[model samples]
Target: MALKKDLKQKMISEIDGNKNYISVEIELQYQPDLIHLLREEINYIGQRFYYKSKDYKLEMCGIGYLLEARYSHLEHDEIYEYWQNIKEQLNTMVFHEDKHHLKFFGGFQFSEHSLTNEWKDFGMSHFVLPKFMITKENGRCYLTYTDHSHKFDIDNIEEILNIVESKAQARTVSEPKMVANKDIQSEEWKALVTKVVALMNESVALQKVVLARRRKIEFQDNVDVEDALQRSLDSNEASYLLLFESGKSQFISQTPEQLCQIENGKLYTNAIAGTIARTEDESENNILKDELLNDSKNQFEHRYVVDSIIHDIQSFTKQLEYDKKPTILTNKHLYHLYTKIQADLLSENVLEIVNQLHPTPALGGFPKVEAIKFIEHEEFGTRGFYGSPLGYIDLENNGEFIVSIRSMLVKGKTATLYSGCGIVKDSNAISEFEETDLKFKPMLKALGVM
Candidate 1:
């Protein structure tokens, strides 16, 4: 074991007094229980973030904040510009090896809208470089400590070492008891969908629009953010798992939709819109999948997504390709029509791609502007970070952004789950309602409320 005094002296020696910022990473031969550590520290730290890739190839746990850029009531492009300016100020260094890069984690709101009390902690756009992060990649783990100044505090280093070496038993988080579950805007959402369908049928230019609803679940005791995250991870292995906690609010998601993933100059995304509930029986599941694929309404919904993605990315992308026919992506309770999209990027400007490709037809609607207008005018509540682009971006501009769907917002003893369905000319009000209901089951089960 490396002595705490030796490590601290080494880190102090590496600090350059002239530089305004520094990042120090130490690779650990044995992996630490990051989730357990996060649970132990988040309360005192006040802000935390976590992410797990769909393939389980990458996982990160971030604590506190070394630097952060957050904005409210800013348009997508404006937020991008601000974030770029902030990135210009960062100067980082890594020890042992230069294999890993520092990353900023957070997300944008669904749109420029009023912030509900539940979502105020998360602004219109927010990203942070954590003071300390445990990154796990390909079975190896590394602990990174970052700060704004080159000066090192010996006491701080000693504290970090003690916490890392502690053999404390894992804290217990009993399953919380549910006191109440209420669906928000049930009748109003149905009415809004009916109106949107009528408008889509009336106008040739207006093809589709998606409407979302919220469900509030209250617990008898304050919910354990880490426990809920673990249950969600246990149940959802094929989706992107995310957590962003600030102050009293925590936003969590197990979303299957990839907004965009940029790696080695290659871009990857997905077109997921059409959906159907999965059944217990194998034959019945096959029938449901077939029904979803062959159904003209679902096909139209899926086609709109595919066409819109190609249209959005064509100007800045080349060699773009996707399946001509949609396939089934099965989740714990549902199946969605899925198409994988890949392209060669003309520029590695990730936020630019995010600005252009966000609110895909799957989450918003076809004819992006018109669909968003309909949602803004008709939707019952503000979306906050739900249905938004949420993920991490590294210094090299290579990272993944997943659509924040099948997600929830937690404050104290209450958790508010959000779900939505695309509405087109053929969409039935009752059917769309049922689809959203099926979408809520994953978070519900993860919370042990079902």
Candidate 2:
């Protein structure tokens, strides 16, 4: 690992106009232990910094967290302009799926994200907003610094904010909202879901399967990306976040579950299965929570996810400790059975553990291969970034993943969102449909769709 000064120098050199283009990476060691140093750095960066990255040059498997930078315009494409400003600095980009292959219920003209909604939709906080992030996607990636040059004793993140502010124009609106036209009752969806269900039942799938839907919404006339991001931040459905690429805006999230979280050396994963929305009264809410917990079907539904995670994490950890009893967690709108699982990872690094553990019973079905095949071969629509984990992992490697239960991608005024659920023998189409509707609330409110 290089000293902090050396790493800062490397960053400056890479940014300088005079250097020959060569990819460079430097691991800066920490003096105050990895966690404290990282926490201090992230806390600082959270206040400032405009950031961007392509995608991971490093191998990614089950990412504990991922951070994605997105660009969205009002009515036209302007990525080239943004790219021109930082092309030389970027190292990778997130893969863009061809529109022809993707299904559209409400599919729109633009959607760009690094799958963090998969983590956020499930209620896991988006990646830690690392003081520094190694971000990638769309054939581009970069190691962005949140803080540099400890030489100058900066007391606040204002300088970083200034750097971010300088790169982009002020947002055009007070809030960004989603505009989509979707017909869930359409025959097209029926056929697609029917085919997917058959494939899932026949394959080595996880016990549950989540299917998502999306539609595109365009701004009526004038709206900026910043407006959308700010609206997302202020949405009641869920919290909002601004990833890398501080310029153009993309809004993601409203998830209600946590997939995996690593703090210090302890790992916590949640079994978020089953769903029931809250009502007007406390008595009704309590009843709903108890009903969700006591409901045989809901319990049965949740077990599939819990079991799958236990199996996956066990692949790397010798001693997996879990809260023996699952608990009912009530949120603003719904109630869910959330079981917390913890273990000390056996791998030398946390990234490996994430790879082996992702697509748990919650995301994918019981047998991952079959469930994936079912979705790939049978479903007419593509999931896009809806069901994928999106969050950030700092140099210390501690991070979290939300279920991606309620999230969307944005490009310009157009956007697309996705939602899915576990379909067991008992999962009725109508019930599952309702479940997905509840799931959409997070981003729905963010986009003003609801």
Q: List, residue by residue over 190-303, the lDDT tens digit for candidate 2.
A: 555565556547864445555555555555543343344445445543322322122233445556555566667777777877778788899878878888878887788788
Q: How high is the CA lDDT of each candidate model?
A: 0.82, 0.47
Clashes of each: 0, 70
Model 2, residue 345: what's the lDDT? 67
Q: Provide the RMSD of all predictions against the true structure, rounded to 1 decimal.
A: 2.1, 13.0
Model 1, runs deviating above 4 Å: 1-9, 43-45, 75-89, 154-158, 165-173
Compute the lDDT of residue 108 as modeled in candidate 2. Answer: 14
Q: Which candidate gets the maximum lDDT versus the true structure?
A: 1
Tell me how many residue pairs clash in candidate 2. Answer: 70
Least accurate stretch of 10 residues (summed lDDT) in model 2? 99-108
